[model samples]
Target: MTQDLFDPFAPVPETPAKSGNTPEFSVSDLSNALKNTVEDAFSFVRVRGEISGFKRASSGHMYLALKDDKAVLDGVCWRGQAGKLGLVPEDGMEVIVTGRLTTFPGRSKYQIVIETMEVAGEGALLKLLEERKKKLAGEGLFDADRKKPIPFLPDVIGIVTSPTGAVIRDIMHRLRDRFPRRVLLWPVLVQGNGAAEQVAEAVRGFNDLLPYGHIPRPDVLIVARGGGSLEDLWAFNEEVVARAVAESDIPVISAVGHETDTTLIDFVSDLRAPTPTGAAEKAVPVRGDLIGQIEENGLRLSQAVRRLGVEKKTALESLARGLGDPKRMLEERNQMLDNWADRLPRSAVNVVSQARARLNETSARLVSPREQLSEKRGRLENAAVRLDGAMKSALQMQQARLDRASAGLRPSDAKRDVDRAGKQIMDLGARMGAAVKNTLTREAEGLARYDRLLESYSYRNVLKRGFAVVRDGAGNLVEKSADIVTGQGYDLEMGDGVTRVTAGDATTEPASTPTAPTSGGARDGDDMPVDAVASSKPETVSKPKAVKKKDPQPKDDDRQGSLL
Candidate 1:
């Protein structure tokens, strides 16, 4: 297979042998050599082509093929550089990329590592702007349903434009002449690099202002700028600025330039005022015109009221004329009143007679106040006398009972009771003392017995009674003859001390008088003489046999002594 120049794994081109020897190169060395050469030659090159296969990866790096009608070149913009381009690359966009040419060894291809990309000219910028416009329009930012109605007379007006430009002056002067309102001016750059971001941020900042904050929120917004060329006015055409205007909670008036100027923001805003001055006019009604209209309305209302009142008065007079003369009507009313007056005194006399009869009958039915008081007084006296007699009887009974109870509770009787209680207390104290003593004695006897039991089981006591403990070569207690190997050394601990000795075979002759060992001093691993074994029969070995030498174990100085 043919090797590509940029591939790191590609085989190096072979060189013809010169006198049976030629310089050598590795695949990686050749790839590096080619990469350096191309990078050095095109370190600061600029190429113009139409962008194709454009995409931004999740890592923010932008990749595209910069192609013409006949050829194509691979291009890449790193994340940082791509962000600073100020324009998102799209298919068919003609752009000029300035960067160094570099080879990707793994891919076996060369690509331009772009540091910056820009539209080739105004045409390319317009194409890019148009693509972006379509995208945002598809998202419904420019829909009429998203548009908010501008306030007819807002309490406060917020203007977003360059603070030092004529846009602000025109907007402010127009507002003052028309109708003065509180103006909140947000200062921002209207052109050049990062202008779109600043303008979008300004729009969001105004919207973020709290409705009841220390700084009052604007009732309506006026995004204005002075006249400029398409490049100078590109900030307003940015999708960021357009979307910002679309999402603003307050109504927005887009006034970017002269009457002929247009931008994406103009379509997205709630109202498109042709100029900054027009925006101000749209934000508020003219003060003089409003006052004039008010006066005209007032005049019309007053004239209508006068016409209505005059018509109603004329109608009333016509109705009054239809009635009879006033003097004859008054004479008839006077005659009727005189007749009523003549009958009123006789009716009053009859009512007075009826009321007098009712009073007399009521007076006969009701008892006199003096008689009622006299009866209540008689009842009170009877109750008082009965109460006095009852009190006397109660006092006599209480005194007799108290005397009887006191007669039994005398000083002598109190002494007798106290003496009896003292005798009982003495007896109880003596019996309690005897019981506590007996309990202590029984507990002491039990404790003594437990102490004796513990002492009887003590290792020292058992050792003192002519016994020795044997630990095998593994330092474990030898509980059976099977646990001991005949030739293995073991530790023998007695009441006085421990000694190392080898186990003797379990063979024995008839019991004979004890004698000294036949071997010299019974060296470790030496078998004890058959006459010394106390048993008669030899034990058969069942377990696997191993003879291990035991290391010397240190013992406390007090525990190191010969057995008596």
Candidate 2:
């Protein structure tokens, strides 16, 4: 190797002498000095170390340190912004933390903010039981009351686990041995970050997809995973996983982790099994045992039916034996029985003949009454029919007679009715007239009789008793006997309208003096003075005028005429 400043294959280098510092430089040049020089100087930093200190804050911030036999470097995490560290940082944990070199200005310290923290070999299994407990408890998944009861026998089953995992294989094997039936598998992640959501989705989907009625709605379910650390089984403790188990209508059999490892799903499940195989066994009855039991029950049912049949037959046989028939014992007596039977037929014939004789006698006796009854019935029926015809004819004749009578009596009855009414009116009028006449006559007769009695009885006594009469100058009868006019023309009516009397004169027997004239016409005896005519004549009657006739003209006219 020749020591030369220039390369034959490239341009020679130019040297610049050191000069005083200039007040000029590009920001890129200074940045480039730090970036490139620091990058080149600290590039490929091989950190062969052991983890000394570790911290995980409640804020999910990780703080740690890396140290070798000589020196140590501080490491920090800015919350959860990366994948999980391969190993937990504890004292004496071999690791290699890879990251870009950076400086902290607070103390101007250079450190490595870990982009990756890898442990050399296997560190330790994360036995985060407290965290697991807290996670499961926070979900309230360990409540026993939330557990559903597993169906005694399921027609359909749903298994949520890895399809290729031994868990499914074990369950299938155990189920075949127990129930020997097909099981539905929903392949899902069971050991990673998405394990809880995947397993929960599978459980919910089976429940959501279940059919109606009991035609076997995925009757039981199993959530399973192989054994691992708490982190490996942590997905089952998530709220999604726990609530999935709790919300299942079908019974959930939680088969996760080792038997010693407990999970939140195990508490909330209807039944918990140590392994997936155990869960399958718990879910179904052994098919062989079930078959045996069914066969035994069928045998017992057949035996019971046969026993009942035998008992019924025996009872029937006993009943038959108890009914003794005489025909069964009539062996040697066949001929005698036949003869007796023949005699029976002959005796029965004789009895029948006697019965027939009695029946004939009774029949003969009843025949007379029956015949008489029949004749009477026939006569009664004939009479009834004849009576009906006669009644009809009589009704028709009576109807015709009534019509004829109505027709004949119409005009005569009308005339008689009018006549009767007229007669009634005439009778009423005659009665009224007669009543009036009778009343008038009775009153007149009463008056006349009374007057006649008064005159005949009273005047007879007055005249017979020599009651004398006197006159006034005017020829008026003197009511009192003190009236004294010697001579005046006057009329003296005794009991009758006639009387004989003498005349008295004043001086001598005077002749009939003539009356003097006045304004009135000359009246015969009316104007004659008493002194003038002292003498007068009295009238004499030939026959007594019976029952005086009243003048048609008024008597007052005569008086007035005399005055005039």
Candidate 3:
């Protein structure tokens, strides 16, 4: 087998091309050698894999594991390199990491030292953005109610974006084309690792500006950037930037990219514009358009004023026609007064004359006092003379009868007759005196009873019976408790004196005897006497004591029942 070069077990003859001496190395030396060789072999590499176990250290260095279906690799992005990337690496996020492969000599494991990192593709970036959007949406960060209305015109507009970018240039150009506005520029990086933080700071800084400070505060705000790849425009999508936009006091207009590009800032902003130029248009109205609108309104106002003037003039003319002459009206009224004045004195004279005639007729019908008195005196005198004459005649007649009887009788008989006559006269006189005394006694008793009856009905008597006469402050008698209003002061008149007291809202009825119901109706609690209720002032009023029932007396035939 001269051709055993391919055979693994075949022994071959030694050749004469060998040096005897070789360099020796330790395990650490060998490891360092492999490390250098591997780092050099793959100096710059771009890898596409799903990121796993991504962690950012306190040192600002990012470490992660990148994995495909079958294998896994370790990767690290140092602080400087990490800061250059626009996107943050998230676990399970597919990414393209560009770096040098190197080994850690101590651990003897190889890893990629990432110089730059990006999402694997637009699809991967969108997927990550979608997941982030879902998370933020769950927190109600994208609520429509949070959106504020953009001002039609602002005093000053503050912009957070790159100062020298085309986005700013477009906004300024558009603003100049429409209405010029005062602008304040807060220069910030539009994309990259710290771009989100810069944008957030700029927004917060603008809000913190004072109106009276050296730099005037802006009335509205704009966060703008030109359209680019997802990686290039990703700063606007950061949670920090979105939160800053949402919490800004001033209304914010976001113009982040082309019309088709969507970002998180768009949802949280007060208004979203397709482009920076569009944002400028939304912020203020066109100068020419505003002038035309004002002119149109002025024309309408003038027309309205002219119409009003014509209507007022017509109303004035109509009013002038409706008004009669004031002098003529006054004359007519004066004539009426004159007619009444002329008739008044004549009518008064007629009334007085008729009254005088009636007075004369009435006087004639009346009896004069002197004549009536004289007539009465004459009648009295005539009656007295008649009475005296009749008495004398009767006495004389009696004397003659007596003389005749005396002549016809013996001395003894005459003496007896005289005695009998004397006895009869004495008896008659005694009887007259007794009757007069009895009549006087009866009349006196009647007068005493009449006086007693009068006294009983007197107000003094009523007052003496422990009853009071209540009167208001004005001295008007209050017959019922309802007559006294709260806060009013009244006088209570007892037999001895009057007392003034303030009235309270508590209502009290005069002490009423509880009568047994003939109709057998049950009495409710309200029907019970309020006298049982405590008095606010004990000294002013005494509570009513319940009266005990008395036995009924037998009815008298002539007795009249009186309701007391």
Best of the candidates, TM-score? 3
Task: Report the Cα lDDT for candidate 1.
Answer: 0.77
Instruction: Sort the candidates on lDDT, descending order.
Output: 1, 3, 2
Model 1: how far is 342 from its true place, Å?
22
How does candidate 2 fare on TM-score? 0.40
lDDT by residue for model 3 (354-442), tens: 99999999998999899999999999999999999999999999999999987896888779999999999999999999999999999
Q: Distance (Å) between predicted and true CA of 247, model 3?
A: 3.4
Error of 1 at 28 (Å): 4.8
Estimate TM-scores for all models: 0.50, 0.40, 0.53
- Candidate 2: segments with Cα more than 4 A from true spot: 1-140, 212-217, 326-564
- Give the clashing residue pairs of candidate 2, or none: none
Global CA lDDT computed for model 2 = 0.64
Provide backbone clash counts, one per model.
0, 0, 0
